[model samples]
Target: MLMRKTAALLLLSLPLALARPMSTLAQAPVQYNVAFPNAVHHEARVTATFRELPAGPLQVRMARSSPGRYALHEFAKNVYDVAATDSRGRALTITRPDPSGWAVTGHDGTVTFTYTLFGDRTDGTYAGIDARHAHLNIPATLAYAEGLEQRPAQVQFAGLPAAWTVATQLQPDAAGTTYSAPNLQYLMDSPTSLGEQQVRTWQEGGRTIELKVLHEGTPAELDAYAAQTQKIVREAAAVFGGMPAFDFGRYTFVANYLPQTSSDGMEHRNSTSLTSRRPLRGPGAIDNLGTVAHEFFHAWNVERLRPQDLEPFNFSQANISSNLWFAEGFTQYYGELVLRRAGIYPTDTEYCQEALTGLVNAMMLSPGAARFSPVQMSQQAPFVDAAAAIDPNNRTNTYLSYYYIGAANALALDLELRARFKTDLDTYMRALWQQFGSQQQNYAPARPYTTPDLQRVLGEVARDTAFAGQFFRQHIYGHQQPDYPALLAPAGLLVRPARPNKASLATRLSFNAADSTATLGTTTSGSPLYVAGLDREDVVLRFDGQRLVGSKAFEELLSTHRPGDVVQLEVRTRTGLQTVPVTLTEEPALEVVTYEAAGRPISKAQKKFRAAWLSSKVR
Candidate 1:
C-alpha cells in the first residue's frame, strides 16, 4: 500500500539530557527519536535512548512476531544502519547476537541505539510511513531491550505537519504528540494513526467511544458510518449484558479508510486498527461495518477473555493459542450476527447468505475439513495466518482457516444448544464475560482458559456435562464434519448444493489469461484430477486436443462431455509436457445455499423454532 510523504516522524521517548547521572537514569523514560529525511526511499531513521542499562551484553531486538498475530513477521528485516552509542556520543561495541537481535556492550551505563526501518505495508500488524502520516504498530517500528520490557515508555512524533493529529489508545501527555505506555505489552497492542483525521465520539454504557477516521468522505458520510458503528457496539454490548470496564474508561477505533491501505481489522486491548479500501456509505459499507463488529467483539473475547496459552505475549516469537477457534472464530461468528440483530442486515436471507458464504460452506466444501479438526486447524495458524510472504505452499487442500472452521463449530453448537436445552451461545458467552472480562480482570499470561475450561463452561450452560463432552469429542477434537443439514434442520433451514448433479472438470484451476494456460490449484481428493496424478502448479496446455483458452473455455469443454467420459489432457509440469489420459467425472457439488426448505411448508412449531433461534431474546 502507498502512503503520503510529509515531515512528521515518530520518536519513542521523552527528551532527556545526555549528561544525566547513571543512578538517576533508572527513573529516566526511554525515548525514541525518528526522522524521515529520506521519504522517497520509504525509510525512517529511528533512535532509542535508554536511561540506564544492565551490566554485560545488552540485547536490543526487534520483534519477530507479536500478539494477536500467529505468524512470524521478522520485523528486523526492515531494520538497517544499526548503531549504538553511550550518553557521551562515543560508539559502543555492537555485535549481532542473533538474526533478530543486536548486542551492545561496553556502554557507559546509558545507551542510545539507532536504525532505519523501511515500512510500506499499512495494516493492523505492520508500519506504513510516507511523509504525510505515519501509521505505527509499535512492534513493527520500535526495538526494545531484552530485559527492559517491564519499564514505562514514552514516545513523541517529531516534526509532524501542523494540521495533522494523532489517534491511539496510549495515554497522551500535555501535548498530544507525545504518548506513554505502562509497559511493552501495552505499547505493542497500541496502534497509532496520524494525519488529517476526522474524530467522532459518543458514550455507550458509561464508556466513551472514539472513532478516528482517515478517509475520503464528508462529515455526513462519516456520521452515517459512525452511526452504524455505534449500532454494532451497542448490539455487541447487549450480548455480554453490559460494557467492559474499558481501559481508561474509553475505547478507540483507529480507522484508515484510504484507497491505498490494505483491507484489515485487528483487535487490541482497548482499541482496534481498522483499514479498508472502501469509503463509508457505499456498497462496501456493510462489509466494512462487519469488520468493525468483529473487532469490537474481540475486546471481550481475545483482548481480555483470552486463552491462558496466549497471555503474556512474546515479542521475540510467534504467539499461538489453542483457542483461536473461539478467540477469532467466535468473534467472527458474532461480528456477523451482531449486524443482523442491529437492523443493518434486516433480513434472514441476508444473514443466511453470510453464514453459508463465510462459515458453513467453507467447512462443508473444503477437502481439508475432513482431514483436520478445528483444534488442529488452530495449531496451523502460525503457518497459514498471515505468515511472511516468501514461498508457495499448497494450503487449499491441506488447510482450512481456523476462523471458518471455528465459526462453523460455534454455529453447530449454538444450534445444538437451542435444540436440546433451549439455551444459546449467548448465554454461554455472557457467563464467560462476567467471569473473565468484567471487573477489569484482564488476562495475565498465566491465567488463560483452556479447552477443558471451554468445555466446562459449555456443560454448565447446558446443565449437562455429558452432552458437552460428546460435542467436543465429535466436533472439536474428532475429524467428523459437523452434520450441517441435520443441525440446521432444527432451525427450519436447509443446506443443499448450488447445482444438483452438475458435470464438472473435477479439478480447481487458476487461469492465466496472458498465456491462456490453466494452472492447477486444489484438486478434490479422489477426484479425476488427483487420481490421474495431476499435481498443483501443473499447467494445462490442451484439453481434448484443443488449446486451453481460459477458465470459461475449460468449463465449456466440461459441459460438452458427460460423466464417465475419457479425455486427453496435455499437461506441463516441471518434468515436461505429457498427455495424460484422464476420465471425466461428476464432481461432488459442494457449493451450497441455505433457505427455509421449500415445499415443506413451515409448520407453527417450525416457525417458532426459527423465530426463537434468530431473535435476540433468550429462550
Candidate 2:
C-alpha cells in the first residue's frame, strides 16, 4: 500500500515539472520598434511588446535613473499618450498605478504597450531628437515590463533618413536595423546614436576599438581627432597592462559634438557616450580630448572594477556608493595625468600650473574638505550629482566634489607609494583589475569590490599593512588632509599662494548697477565675510568710505589693500542698514609651480622623479 501511494505522488509531480519548461519556452523576446515621425519637435513613438507573460497584471515602467548617474531623473515625465492592447488586438484595461509606470490587466499572456517620448536635451542621461539626428539614452527612451527583465530584448530603428546610420554597443543583427541584448540591464546601458556619422576603427589587442562622431566638422578634422584619440587609448591601456575583455569583442566611442548637444561623458560596460556643444577644432578640440581620456578610463574603473555598492545598478531610484572617490576620483587624476603622459600638455609647468594647481587648491582651501571625509562626500552624490532643486544649498561651505577629493587622494597615495614603497598607482590599479575587474559574468563584474577590499588591495600592493591602515584612517575614513607641500617637494614643485599680496573678502559679490551696491553670494563658512556678520544677499553700499559704483569698484578697493588691512563697509541686511568692520585676508587660493620657475635650484634627483612620474608608460 505504501509503494502504491509513492507511485501516485511521483506521477502527479511529473506533470507539474513538465509544464514549467513549456511555459518558459513559450516566452518570446521583448520587441521594441522606435520611429521618429515627428523628429522636428523632438518626439519619437516607441512600441514595446512583451509576449507570453505570466497570468497577472503586466507592470510596465520607464526607468527613473540612468547608468553612470546617481540621481533620480523620473524618465516617465516625458512619456505620454500611453495605451496597451492584448495579443488578440483587444484593448486591455490600463490603470494609473504610480508616477513612474502603468499596470495593464487582462492581458491574455501578451501585451503591446505604446507611448510617445519627448526629448530635447542631447547628453548622456537624456534623449535628443531633431531633423539632423536622434540620440537615445536607453533608460530615457524605452519602457520595460516588470517580470520580463531577464528575457532577451530586440530594438529596431525605423524611418531613418537616407544618410543616417546607427551606432551603439548593442549586438547587431545581420540586417543592421535591429539590435539585441541578453537582458534588460545591458539594453538600458546601451545608448544609441542615429545620424550621419564618420566611422573609424582600429584593432587593439585582438579587439576592435571604434569611434563614431556626429559633427558638422570636415572629414580631415575628424581624422585628426581620431588619431589623437588612438594615442589616448594606447596610454590608457598601458596603465591596466592591457585592454578590458570588451563584450562582443569590441568597444566604441559614440560622440556627438554638435551645437544642439550638452556637455557630458557617461561610461558603460563596452561603450561611452561623448556629447558636447564644443566642436572638434581650435581650442575646443583639445578640450574634447580631455573628456575622451576621462570617460575611456572609466571603462576599467567604475564600469568593471566594480564598486560593491553600485554593483547591479538600480534603475528605479538613485544609487549611492562610498567608493566614488576611488572610482571617480582616481579616474579624475588619471584623466589629466594620461593627457600629460600622451604629450598633450608637453611641459611639466603646463601640467602643474593648469591641472595640478586647481586640484590642490580645491582640496586644500575648501571648507567642505575640512568638514567631511571622502566617504561622506561620496555619499552626498545623489543630492548633488546632476540633481535638481529649487532652494539654495550651502554646498560651497559643506561639500567638495568627490572627483576632486578622490583625485587629491590618488595624487597623495601615488606619491607616497613612489617615495616610500618604491611602487606606483599603476601597479596598484593592475592588481585591482586582476582581482575584481577582469572577470566578467553575465554582463557584470564577477567580483565587485567593497571599501574593505580596496584597502586590502592597497596593503598588499605596498607590502605594508600598517602604512595602508594609517593612510586609509587619516585620508579615506578620517578628514585629515595629506601634507601636500611635503609630498610635492620630491618633484621639485612648490605650493604657494596664487595671490599673496592681494586682499580679499573670500566671497563672490554681484554688483547691481541700479542701486550702485554689491550683493554677496553664498559666503564660505569661515571666510572673512562669514565671520563679519555678512551672508548671502547682504548689500554693501560703501567700501572704505568710497561709494561702490560699478562692478570694478570693490575689486579696485581690494587691490589697494594688503592682507592685514581692515576695511569699513556700509551694508544693508534683511533687517536694516548697518556699518561693519571686516579685516581683510590674503586669498587662500594655492598654485603648484615648478621649483625652476620659482628661481630655485633643482637637483638631478628631482628631475628623475618628475620624469618618471609624468613620462609615458606606453611601450
Candidate 3:
C-alpha cells in the first residue's frame, strides 16, 4: 500500500491543503490501512482501497483546504507514484487530476493505491523537520476526490509504542486503537503526530487537566514549556466555568519549529497546531506562549460554540461572515485575561497594554481593511480569484485586513461590554458552548445566518440593543476603520501611537514626497505608519483625512508630523465608527534586549527562526 504526498503553502496565517494546483474535481471515499514503520526514524505508509466505486468515469481530487484553515490550497502536486488497480488485483489507468489531484477510473469494484507520505513532524504537508520528528497533515498533503470528504474512513497503524498516549478527536473504541470520525471535516481537523509526547497530568479542584507537548528538544526545556502552558490553560479554563467544557486529556498540542513562516497556531476542537521558532530571546519570543492561550480559548469559543458559517462549513466555497471578531477577537482578549488572572502577566497594565497594542496596530492600518467588505470578502477569500485579488503594489492586503482587524475589535468589545453592561460581556460564548460543547446542539449546519439570528446572540450581552446590526453594518462590513481610542477610554486604557527611536533602527526606512514613510523588509518596525493615525488599520485619507497625493506622497506627508503635537488623527472603532482624537507620542526607542525567564523561551525547532530573523542568539 502507498501513502500519498502533496504540495501546499499557507498564506497569511491560513493553512490550506493543496496537492495539485489547478484541478476541479471532488474527492471520493477511500478506506485505508496505514502504519508507521519507524520510531527512531518516523515514516508513514498508506494502502487505501476504494470499494463501491461510483459508475460514471469518476476522478479523485484532494482538498485544497485543511480542517480549520479556510484558504484553498492545492494538495496533489507533491503526491508521487500514484497507481490504481481493481478488486481482482488488476491494474487500472491513472490520469492528471487537475491543478491539484489525480484520476483513477475503472469498473465499480474495489480499487487500491499505495503511497508513502514523508512524515517528518512539521506543520505543513509532508513536513519532516528532521529524521526523528514528523507531522502528518494528511488532508493538505494527500488527495482523494471532491466528493469523498464525507465518506466513512478508518485507519490502523503500528510503528511506535502502544503505551504512548494518543490524541485525536475521532470516535474511539474501547481498545482505543480503532478510531472513527463522523465525516471528513473531522479527519482533516485531526492532525496526527507520533512520538513520545511530553505529558504532565494533574487533577485540581476535582477536574483533570493535562499538558501534552510533542517535540525532540531537551527534556528540561520541554518540561518547563509543558508546565507553564499547563498553568496558562488551567487558569484560562477556570475563567469560563472552572475547567474546559470538554476533556483535556485527549487534547494534543503539535508545536512545529518552522521560522520565517506563519509562525502561528491553528485551534481545533481538541487540539492545536502551533508553528514557531523555539528558544525565543525575550518578550517578543513569548508571543508563541500567548498564542497558545489564544487558541486554547478557542476550544470553547470558536471550535465548540461556533457561528452559523462554521457550524457546517461549505468545503466547496467560502462561508461568508462578519462576526469573526466575536469568534476570534474575543478569544484573543480572554487569552491575556486568563494569563493575567493566573498571575503570569504580573501586572494589570501589561495585560491592558497587550490588548491595546493589538488595538493600536489596527488603527494604524486602517482603510487597508476597508477594501474587503464583510459580505463580499468573507464569502470570496478562500476562493478569491488570485489575479484580481492582488493590489496595485503587488502586495496582498489580506495579511492585516480581515483576521487582525476583526480580532482587535473583539478585544475592545469584550472590555467595553464589561464596562458598559457591568456584567461578564457575552454569555453567547458560554451559551453556545453549552449547546454545542455540552449538549452537542447545532445552530447553523452548512447554512447562511439571517441578520436577526446574529442580533439575537448579541442581545445576550448588548447594553445598546438596537445598535448591534448598526455596529455590524458600519464598523464590521463597512469601509470605516475601527475606533479604538474611545473604546479604550471608557475602560481607562489608552492607545497612544509610538514614535520611532533616537538611534535604534533595523530595516531601511524612507519617506515619500508627501511625508509617508515605508519600512522596507520582511518585517517592518512601525507597520505602514498606522495608515494615517486611523489606528491599526485606519485608512489614510489625507495628512489628516484628506486624499493624498499618492502612495509616495503619503510617505512624505508622514515625515512632517512632530512629536507631542496634536497632528490630525481619525479612525473607525466598534463604539460608533466615528473619527476621534489620538495624541501621538515620540516613538519610544527599542533595542535588542533579552531577559531570563524562569523557564525555557522556545523549543529547538523554533530557535532556527530567530537565528534567521533576529539580532540576538536564541540560547
User: CA shift at 433, candidate 3, in angstroms?
Assistant: 3.8
For TM-score, candidate 1 versus 2, the one ahead is: 2
| Deviation in Å, model 2, residue 191 alpha carbon | 0.6
Better of 2 and 3 by lDDT: 2
Worst 10 residues of 2 by lDDT: 4-13
Candidate scoring better on TM-score of 1 and 3: 1
Clashing pairs in 2: none
- Model 3 alpha-carbon miss at residue 101, Å: 3.5
Q: Encode model 3's per-residue lDDT on 315-425: one tens digit a residue.
A: 444355555655665676667666665555665456545655655565455334546544444444454423224433412344344455566655545555554565444
Q: Pick the candidate with the highest TM-score.
A: 2
Model 1 clash tally?
11
lDDT of 1 by residue, 459-546 (tens): 9999999998998888888767888788877666777656555566667788878877789876667788889888888998888988
What TM-score does model 3 achieve against the real structure? 0.68
lDDT of each: 0.80, 0.87, 0.51
TM-score on alpha carbons, each prediction: 0.92, 0.95, 0.68
Which candidate comes out best when scored by lDDT? 2
Question: In order, what is each prediction's RMSD in angstroms?
Answer: 3.9, 9.3, 12.7
